[model samples]
Target: MQSRRSRTSISISQQRMLSHSMTGLSLEQQKMLYYVGVDVGTGSARACIIDSMGNILSLAERPIQRQQLKPNFITQSSQEIWQSVCHCVKSVVRDSGVPSEKIHGIGFDATCSLVVVEEKSNKEVAVGPDFSNTDQNIILWMDHRAIEETAEINATGDKCLKYVGGQMSVEMEIPKIKWLKGHLPDNKFAECKFFDLADYLTFKASGKETRSFCSTACKQGLLPVGVEGSTEGWSRDFFHQIGLDELVEDDYRRIGGSVKNDNKGKNFLSAGEFIGAIDESVAEELGLSNHCVVGSGVIDAYAGWVGTVAARTDVSLPALAKSDREKVGIDRATGRLAAVAGTSTCHIAMSRDPVFVDGVWGPYRDVMANKFWCAEGGQSCTGALLAHVLTTHPAYTELSQLADAASVSKFDYLNSRLESLAHQNKARSVVHLAKHLFFYGDYHGNRSPIADSSMRAAIIGQSMDNSIDDLALMYLGACEFIAQQTRQIVEKMTVSGHNLSTIFMSGGQCRNGLLMRLLADCTGLPIVIPRYIDAAVVFGSALLGAVASESFDKSGAKSAISASRKSSIAGDLSQHNPKNSLAKFGGIGGDDLPSPYTAPSATASTSQIATVGFPFPAPDDVQEEQFDEDEESGSELNFKAQSKWKKDMEDRMKGRSSDNGDTMWNVMYTMTGSGKVVQPCAESHPDRVLLNTKYKIFLDMADTQRKYRQMVDAVE
Candidate 1:
């Protein structure tokens, strides 16, 4: 394939002629904007180049090395991971043939693993039991070595724990940090500075220690600046109570800064907010432009949410006027969950208000969107469980041979085998083929709605037969377990206040047709797959890059207003008198919020939005005037009412400075994209009934385990 630059290459004379011909266009219009998104997963680092419209231009991936030092203790070399990142990034840029100068921004997302660096040496520090290997500095997210610390922290019952689903997991940064302090030599622990892997990538790129709200809020337990009834951002008392007062005493320098102390110099940016320009040396190494800015990074799962949550859905509401379609979209978004499935599955759901689901991590403020709260529920082992079941089964070699012979993957062959078994058994569906099999896949422990790391898996109804058919049955059971747990999680979320109606799924799991179908049937929710299934998380990072680009910040309001003016409704309003149309609708005014009618000025900085006591509008009232719509006489009254509401909000915020704040209003441009919808099978009612019965048994299994533990303890 010809490279993009090779195909578009032109001589100086042709360039001059082309430049002269394009003189009528603005600089922004003449240049094609591109962004690079890099995603560091548990097994590989993937990168992609995307146009401004969210289309993937070129992609590259490189494998990352991991070492399992012991059971539940996994480690990786940050140096090696960075090398893989650089390699993938450079490959994407070279393969795409897009000029480095044209790549306006770059963003990164990674597994929420912990990276340890020595403050003095600026080098990797050993995180594994082997102190000699400094290269193994990253504690993989699946590492559960912090189980004791997690239990100790949870025992304190600190008020801060409420924000993190009433208990911190061994997977979170706090417990891991505590584990390091207790286990590592005092001098080594004192010398370390910890970073969530995502923040580490951004810090490496920008040469800045700025942390992302997605990382700090979701993983590090930083109270978002704007949560109601909270004045201080970090809970110093909680930190002290948890026996990690050194962090508080040091003003959180090792992690991030104290949110309460302005002197700490720790900057926390939300997702898509600009961090800084890439470091010159790093830029050269990655083959990117020095001018390219870096965006605030997100945990890989949140990046999955960023990539898929804003997808256009087919649902339309008659009650909402055409002008209120943006409102409708927001409503739809709140009802849709983004299930980023891979080695583990993270179910991310947003709500207009905080929804505190027990065992689910969050009510995290301003992580995904500016005002919306996000809840994350997860299963610690899904993909890994399937892999384990297949790779360990006696008939695994037979299954692999058959799959390879048929020119299909093992999963594909298993899915086909399950379908054939259902047909042979005259079952209602493939789901019925596993009716007698039950798998409680907590092999790595449950991450959410249970928050237990000590839990174990229980498989019932296994046969003595060691055949390919038996292996297929085991795979089906594991898939069913994953889907049923999803249903349990959704139920927990719904009970807690989130009204999830659809599942926007991303990551490698999206390619599993069996799992996808099972997820929909088991959850009874339609699953929407993104355009690039495996690349969705990276694409989301690219969207972040597009948002952070200088062109986006400078021309955002102009583009919004221009697009609004082209709308039939705005056109009709302009027909009466074009010059004063905006004034007529009360759009021409000084406002505290990021509105389409006003361009951001120097006085309005992004930081001001984080100030204590700023009266941000209620979530429902945000961005009502920003989206454009078609004209409809029947909706004129509704538009007028919205205009009145906007004017009221402006009056309320009149004295506030319109300075810098990273708001989602500017993100509208990058949010429009396409996806494939996987609706629930219409004929799966009988399967649904069978699954519902198994789901009841699934719930009972957890309770029975607890009872068994109690009985065993009492005897002791």
Candidate 2:
């Protein structure tokens, strides 16, 4: 199939792209040399136009098209994704009225999906079941078609697999490649070339074949992504074990044998080095200047990390005095975790020393801007799960019609509706709505701490009521579940020596007032939603641009690539396995933890949850320059929600059904709050235990279905 380019309507004046429609007043627009950050998220491509000081001038987005060929098969068009990127870039440039030549540096970030192309024709290679449809060549990062292959690879117990949470996931490229090798026409495997999606975008934009250290190390499952003190070379034993030794044949060119050396990846940029000047033709095509430099890109979540965490450090460092110098570097950078939440949530923390947490993705040496070791934790779904629940619910049509009538998006309408329902229920907010409904967010799978791909999402206390109120409460429950998952990851990290003081968050969920407040309240950790919350990823990519632009003159980038760069020394990494708890991921069985079978103490009623569990103050719809300029508004907002919230959580778990003869996973769905004191807002005490007694029902149902599938497969 000939996939058409994604298009956007805009004014093109004199072959130099003028800006798109600018909304509201600009927050100090500088017509001087600007940087552009392009972020390709799961659903859309967004671009941010920023000045020298990391202040965003305007933003624009173009949606990418995707195809779900089967329940477990997802595919995309590299050409279309690239086209959408181009459209977003052009649109942002047009929207901000920034001239083509004035744009100095541009950086890109994308989901770590796999893109397959035929080098001979420079066209997508057919990789799906429908071989004739070459456009379906890109495998989405979320696709699970390679699960069996991943399991087979895991069975081999290759050493390199240890770096990836000690398991080979269907999401990684290695397993996907094996699946493709076994599924596709044999010749096609040799005929096509593979590129992680981020690398593909950079190649498309700058005509450079160089890959980012982040993409190759973290996503390809080839480089020892987060493991320290190892050669970043392809594992011959692993390929042979998996029966695809061809990958190493003929100079290992298919997967690129050359990699970042222990000292430095000369060709690899440390998240922000300039890769190449934009190609002349592509520059002209997108109305960008030949002077536009492409910064070394990163995986989308890492980009979000930069957008959030770094907003506190790097941008504000230059102004610090000599006395504050010692405090400026490693300690500050390592103290916070970047929580990039969208379709999925990836928790990234950096440390001067490597952290070896089982069931976590990284502790990769110098992965973040080539300075700190990064540890990665993730949830397979968050906003994506919430969307699924809302859209697939019976109330969706009615909800959508009402949302349309109110001239607002269904999400926004639901938010307002949820607040009204809380008022109607005589509660401070609908946070306690979990009393009538509960949701487990692992619908996609558990990505971190537990690293269980077989895990499934569950909901208890569901009813036939299809009213907007019911849907709204269900949405609230889903958000709380996501918050609980964050706490679980945080607990794992905190236990592993990375005590995160603050959480810097970016992505779609940051804007959801309810989720943000719950995250803060539940975790008892302050979440700084950057002023550029909506464009955080784009800004993160832009920071890469800032580091890449020659005028910006990042000596750190040069020194990182210099011969003086140090190789990480190997550490004693004999780490214990993450606990496999059916009831919880956070210290599920330690003496410190409460017994799973134990009942909650006679704590006060949950009336206080409704009191302190209020949403963070509604964000100013348009962020002001004062907040935008201060970048590190590690601006902490605390919801004085503690005791009652904790008691309610305890109640939800106390009466859950056990697996008597079957093994029902005791998924942790809520956080035990921080003992931090906050001014009390309400004191109404109410008994709300919605998930008790029903836990075993959902668990049994899921287990039964799970076994039924296994039995059916065996019969086949």
Off by over 4 Å in 1: 1-30, 226-229, 260-266, 313-332, 550-552, 555-672, 682-684
TM value for model 1:
0.80
Give the Å shift of residue 8 in candidate 2.
36
For each of the candidates, the C-alpha root-mean-square deviation to the true structure, in angstroms, is 13.4, 18.4
Measured by TM-score, the strongest candidate is 1
TM-score of each: 0.80, 0.71
Candidate 1 per-residue lDDT over residues 271-380, each given as its tens digit: 77766667767988999855577888999998888778765433332321232344432343566688998889999987778889999999898776666678999999
lDDT of 2 at 632: 27
lDDT against the true structure, per candidate, is 0.72, 0.61
What is residue 9's positional error in candidate 2, in angstroms?
39
